[model samples]
Structures are given as C-alpha cells and as structure tokens.
Target: MNMAVIGMIAGMALAFAGYFGGFGAFLLVAALGAVGFVVGRFLEGDLDIGDIFRARDDRRR
Candidate 1:
C-alpha cells in the first residue's frame, strides 16, 4: 500500500472513470485510496519501517 501503489490505483480509477463516467468511478477511487492509505499505515506501524522522509535515521545518527 505504498503511495506509488495508491497512485497507480488512482490512475486505474481515472481510466475507469474515462470508460464508465461519474459517481461510481469517483467512489471507487476514493475507496482504493483509503484502503491503500490504511494498509500503508498499518504496514508501517507493524513493521516499524517507514519511508525515508518519515524515518529520519540520519538525523538520529
């Protein structure tokens, strides 16, 4: 559930929107984004790992 994954999903949603149009596509994108964000947060917390921007290992050193 990385941001990159979410972005790719969002791109998919847009592609769907282009084909399907309107509310359903928007909702699908929203759901995908939310799910991705939650999964990303859960993984980060459970694994004690984080993105470089948030990890700040160098600062700690």
Candidate 2:
C-alpha cells in the first residue's frame, strides 16, 4: 500500500476513535497519524529533517 494513502486512512481512523473512545483517543490517534506520516515520509525519502527547521531562503516571493 502507498505510504501516503495509509497515512490518510490512519488519520481518518481518529474519527471513529473520537466517536467511541472520546477526545483523548481522538488526540492520541491524531498524533499517531502525524508520526506515521513523518515516518513514512522519512522512509520514502521525502522528508528532510534539516529542512523542517530550516529558514526559507527563497527570495522570489
């Protein structure tokens, strides 16, 4: 399965968690989804750790 798709589905699962488990569960699931997304991006070579905190250097704006 595509990592992006899996991340989206995992994020959506928070809706069900909210419905049955409450706000805490929703938040936890949401966090997990975010972590999963980052991990997936890292694994897929789409995430650059340095870039996450790097200042924008673009001057074309």
**Could you say which candidate leads in lDDT?**
2
TM-score of 2: 0.69
| Residue-wise C-alpha lDDT for candidate 2, range 1-61, written one tens digit per residue | 8979875777679878999999999999888877977887988999888767776884234
Query: Best candidate per TM-score, number?
Result: 2
lDDT of each: 0.70, 0.82
- Give RMSD (Å) of candidate 1 vs. truth: 6.6
Kindly give the number of clashing pairs for every candidate. 0, 0
Could you give candidate 1's per-residue lDDT for residues 1-61 as a string of tens digits?
A: 7879867877787777757878787777777777776687777785334443465666575
Regions more than 4 Å wrong, model 2? 1-8, 58-61
Model 1, residue 51: distance off in Å is 22
**Superposing all C-alpha atoms, what RMSD in Å does each candidate have to the true structure?**
6.6, 3.3
